[model samples]
Target chain A: MKNPFKFKKEIVNADLFNNDLPLPHSEEYPDEEVIFSVKDFQFYYDNGEKHALKDINLEIFKKKVTAFIGPSGCGKSTLLRCFNRMNDLIDGNKKEGEILYKGTPIDTLNTIQLRSKVGMVFQQPNPFPMSIYNNITYGPKCQGLRNKKSLDKIVYDSLNDVGLYEEVKDQISHSGTSLSGGQQQRLCIARCIAMSPDIILMDEPTSALDPIATLKIEELIRKLKEKYTIIIVTHNMQQAARISDYTAFFML
Target chain B: MEKKNKKINLSYLIERNIKNRKYKDGITNGSTFLFSLLCVVILFLVIGYVLFTGANYLTPGFITSNYSQSSVALRTPKDFVYNENDYDFSDLERFDDTYYSEKWGIGLQYGKDNNQNQVIYLVQMSENSPFHELVRRDDGTNFNIPSDMYLSYITVQTELGTYKTAFSEDGIENMISTLDEAVSIYDSNFLTLGGGISTSLITTCYLILFTLIFSLPLGIGGAIYLGYYAKDNRITRIIRSLVDMSSGIPSIIFGLVGATIFIPFVGSMTGTTGGNIFTGALTMTLILLPTIVKTVEESIKTIPKSMISASLALGASNTETIFKIVLPNSIDGILNAAILGIGRTIGESAALVFALGTFITAAPSFTSGNTTLAVHIWYILAGEYPAYEQACAISIIIFCVVVVLSLSTKLINYLFRRKRER
Candidate 1:
């Protein structure tokens, strides 16, 4: 008799629709092709007892790698999560100001559509408890991609893109969490990529990995920037300098 | 509020303190060991007493035979043949104390009857035996010897002479030899009495299956709602506290509920006027839901919050995330719940007595009221002539199932951990 969904204010519909269209005024923005524009964006937590981010202004260009580097508790990851509205899940967390995705406010777009295009990877590699193939296909399958051939292609291509194919190609049906910490992060990125998103956000993805794996992910990021716009938050200054084309410093 | 100054003790002299410390340690250590030893001893005492008493009565006939007795005064088979080496009793496990006639293919053992009075048991009857071919004397209807039977009286009429003996006045060897030499056996066995628990064992199995069938889904659903989706509020808190409290209530209260609610409800479909196994199963479901939910909730809670976020971040809906991520992760706990439910269902009694009557017979259907192992124990012990040994025998059977269930739980969890590790 006690229902949990009854307490929820938002009913999320993540179904695919045929009405999605391309961004408006794309040509009017000129040659730079600014992917996301944050103007006076401020964030607070715990009913404003904590001000996480304030008056932040930044522009992320298309097919470019931008990094947010700062000391701890500076809301770098907070701002990154705000891009996909991941912070919307928490209770009593308030946000003021606006973020524009390709000259259109992100709030106007459907949450499913917005998140489909703006994918994210967490600080710790948290793969869903499932086989590698199922883990990679979960998002696409949810949106009704049922063609077995295409699903297999998506799985192979995404794993290959992150350079994890060579290591885990034989055990695609194995559990995703069984992989090493480094391989798990790469699998998380591959899972995000399997959705074919336009942007990929990584929050300290390599923090838990060894240096060799970090180098591989940095190399993957450099190669990935040619096709997808990336926004990463990291405390490693050299990592920001090595991988990111544009860097912004964040503070509490 | 006023604060009192507390004195903290420090060892003024380390060497002097060592003696005091050793003295206190000895007392504490001895008491801890003593209490733990007491716990182990109590466990073994209960198990050993039950096993020692019950093991004596736990025969194949006691486990696999019927609960009631059926008697036939006269029976004759339409096609009767007595051939040499017609059947062999050599392969059968011999009760050394039994009188086995290899020529007639019958083994008769001295076992206690239903009332614990010493009687001759018809332990074995191989194919083509005269007993299997015999017919009722009064009505001339064929009466097949049940695999499990007791020898009340046997009469043999041979070409040489007529030999007869009652169970009480048996030179069993002479009677059986006379049986082997018979040209025709006459009204051989009369009044096969009941002592076995085949009905109760089967009833326990059915109740366990039906109880799990009804309770697992509800328990898992409640656990998922509380673990993944529920808001921490007064209503949920109340529901949680109720679940905890329900597990503590006596099983008899649940039996009363089943009697009041489920008996009539099931009776409508089953056409049973009294308490039935289905009603008992419903009661068992009510009793087991709390354990199932609690274990599942504990496992579901152990799943990292990041996995849920990761799924949602990948554009999967909350529903999709739960089915794929949360449910799969908590499978070990669900299995554990099922095994625990089975163990509880086997050992349950008081509630089942109210929901299912302690009438052990041929389980005509789930609609027919019958006793489970635990309820059978209660029925036997509750009588004026308490059959403690029989009750203990039933206890041994219940304990076996529970032990096997618990061991399988451990095996399943181990396999799960190994799979996850791989």
Candidate 2:
């Protein structure tokens, strides 16, 4: 499918592409703790019939926000999915070289354990066809958290963290899909947070949303950096400059 | 001036072309619509005719009563004779005996014989008597009384008077001495004459119940395996094609299979010699599996891949995801398959006749031979005297049941869709 945000790359002078936005510079985080390091990473599709990403090396610092920015078909989202082994679901996909999480090779860790600690939000807000309350508690419940009071607290805190608690408190029992696109994205973020993961991956999470919802998500990411490591893929350069402390550019 | 003229010509040409296309489209569309409407009309007419004809015979007694009635016949003695002076003739009203030449009537009268002992005389009354007329009018014919039979009384009635004339005491004694025994016979009621379908109905219910019980789990399990776990390889592809092909195979073939395989298997288990409801249900299960599996697989496919991914991402196992997410979403399809299966079971006759037997028993046992509603209709129609009225009534009942099943299926689907939307 052709990327819907392809025009954003051509519009260099657009507000979202501004270089003068007030943002935390990466220089201040030079000595921060490194959580993940990629060494000579390579990714392939269809059993190496097609090369998707090549010669990638990068580091994600602890409790810091990192962003990958590029045009469509540049493998930004593909590389982000590699962190949580989401690429394992696709048939005929292969990866070479090493990825380390806290100085341990990621291959040694169980995929389920890796995923629970490294949650992901997709480009579209693909919430399960269930109530908002269940959506938030799904991850926690899967982790064997069954106490009702604890679940309630987790739901309130997660929704509160994404600033959606007040807007949806009256109708929390409503389907998560019934919310607007912005609220749905926030719900997805809240759902990711409820797992209490150490790292959260966002794959163009705001591409399907309006500018207002995008700004809200960027602000949430800025606040979330204090508690969790965040990595986001975006085609909008200014979003990366505004919310991320470190930015890596990919070229097809 | 020339440009303006050309513009007007162009506009006129476009308008003519548009009108011409619309006229052609209308003809094709109208013809197809009329043909479809005609088809629907014909279907309704057939159903209406069945209901109209069968409504006359669909009485409550027809459903509840047994097949035959018990009756007996008694014969009188030949030695008894009538005496004119034995009974009073004062109240007698006489009629011409022109209507009495061949008809004879029997009447019972209590009197004393020659020995002065009380006896009941079986009298052969004359054709001109009131008892003969009463019997003829009620029974639609005259009694065939034998010659030389004795009489104890002759009852005659007229507008002027009523009289009871008796025979001699000696004739009554001889009649009582020579009379023979009474013999019993059973006459079939309306149901035995091909009016009732209670047995067939019960058999159909049994077949549907057991078929579903056997097929649902197997069908759904196979569907889950195919939809979620099976690899998209040559073997799986061949299996899928085989399932599809089996569905298209004539059900009569399945009937043969059931007779050859299921009947013997079930017969051994239940210890019966011939086909029964259990064997028929097993045959139906084989016929229904393809439909159930295909529909459920399709519905499972419709569940978004993202849901599975989301569940897996939440650290849930593959089995957990399948049971909790995939099966729940495919419930509508499962129910739809069951409805279709029921419709097939009810309308099935050729297969069941071979597998379940064609005998309609009043109380069908699981291990005993029986006929379903469809087979019952077939039996009635194929008999020496075709009972179309009762056959049509059974058809009406089957039609109603199928219609109700489909309507309920639609209602459930609609409610599920509405809930999902909410």
Candidate 3:
């Protein structure tokens, strides 16, 4: 007779407490204000159904990196989507609490205007099937900027800021998808930035990437938080601990 | 005792092997292979049969000329006296005297005299060819004239002094000569820009244009409503079911409906009674709309919800997201639907039969009567004389055109997909 199950080896936790900071670090700028406030928010897929998120209250400050760390299906991504009303696309999806961006109700605001102000990067890199130049210029063009010079400048500035400029600047006609996975992910971030949105939400942005690319994106997030309000969802605890100023832990 | 234990162990091992193997092994049955082979065989048979029939009728002259009845019928004098008894020198002088000219000297004549004393002449114009001109001699003898018998005398000279013969006795030969005549006549009479082909071409193009005009936007709009705006309720389910079922209904029924609905409405509104391009287009649109809607709806459904989410998160309205992002991304799918709709419209026969009648006339205006390729094929098939081989040739032409269209559509789709991926 053979044993029903075999032992699958588990590697011990390496790099433990590597990026964790000592508790109670002082704020870099104490004068800055909180831009987003969520109060006792609960998300439900149906009436009296399984609660995806339960009585969660949180704040996202301007020019700060706030991260959510959780296991699979723990509703961390769901809470992130609340800031931009991304949950509205799901049928029968309801929320029980309030989300405020700059003291105004998120639900009552025009969805289009709110989305323009709050941009998001998905876990999977989804660059439009167009030229690298077009990918960066998509949002700006959608906002009705038609001048070639203006578009060129926006493409240049956005790519430069994302550190992908030298690799792609000369190959303007190349496809956006032709880039390396790390570059495509960075291009998505650049696309979010090119919109000039005040808030940027990232949903496990580097989960699909290799280690070196993941490190680059983690570092880039810290630099991005200097100007834009940032909230990132990550399954990797060390990533949340590395760049996030405030970490929210969640469990399913 | 040892032998008994070994036998039990062997039985147990056999049962274990049977249990471990699942039912879905990868072997294919004979029936499936036979059925697949049958389909291929049937397709080849149809193609071979059509080609065989069509080749029997097609000749170079048949393809290029117009029809003339005078080419085949026997010529007889309106008034001539008949001799009752003689076979040889009886009508030979009369035959030569009446038909032979200085250029057409000594035309060959042969055939037996009938009891009525009428001479049936079989005219042998060329020595080795089946092309012979038949002339009726008064004594019932038939004469064969050389193919050049008539053309030899029909000479015209230019200033350069070169004689040009305008008429020939052996009208283009092989298989079905009358159809060859019809093909030539159709081309010469209709296909020229100011003639038949141009008029029919413009009518078809206009019909296609109006069909797109009436069906595309409405179909796409309906698709968007069903795919995006309509809640997944009983009403939507019923609407979807109805559209799906309508596609299964025969096209002829739609033709009948169109004939009853559009012909009278347009006829009353415009104060005219008869066929027109506009009426045909309306009929085609009704036939095409359901197909377009179903195709476009399937395409819209393939768009990921996250794309819409991303757009909405940026504060784009449903309409804005749909128009700006969804539609642009799904352009290939929309184009596929449109091409298929056009192909369906072009090939549809039964619907056009009732909506646009069988008369092959040059349409001068939207209100004028016209016939399309499929309608012409139908008329050729069902005509009083029943031109079978000609109909087969025309069908082959239509089949070739459709094959080319479908192939180009596939090629365009491939290119668009490659460009989109890039």
lDDT of 1 by residue, A33-121 (tens): 67788989989998788898989988887788999998899999989999998998876678899998766677666677778889999
Candidate 1 per-residue C-alpha lDDT over B328-379 given as tens digits, one digit per residue, 9 for 90 to 100: 8889999999999998988888999989888887653576789988888988
lDDT of 3 by residue, A52-94 (tens): 9999887777778889997889999989888887876665677
TM-score, chain B only, every model?
Answer: 0.81, 0.68, 0.63
In every candidate, what fraction of the native interface contacts is reproduced?
0.71, 0.49, 0.49
lDDT (10s digit) by residue, model 3, range B279-323:
788888888878888888887887777666655655556777788
RMSD of 2: 13.9
Return the top candidate by lDDT.
Answer: 1
Model 1 clash pairs? B74-B135, B74-B136, B74-B137, B75-B135, B75-B136, B75-B137, B76-B135
**Which residue pairs in model 2 clash with each other?**
B80-B150
> DockQ, in order, for the candidates?
0.62, 0.40, 0.33
Which lDDT tens digits does candidate 2 get at residues A1-252? Answer: 224246322111222123233332234365766777888999999878889999998888878889999889989988998898878777677889989776666776676677877889888888888899999998888777899999999999999999999999999998998999999999999999998888999999999999999989999999999888999998888888999988989988
Query: Model 1, residue A130: displacement in angstroms?
Result: 3.6
Q: Estimate each model's TM-score.
A: 0.85, 0.74, 0.73
Which model scores highest in DockQ?
Answer: 1
Q: Model 1 reaches what TM-score against the true structure?
A: 0.85
Over 4 Å off, model 2: A1-30, B1-27, B62-194
Supply candidate 3's per-residue lDDT for B262: 88
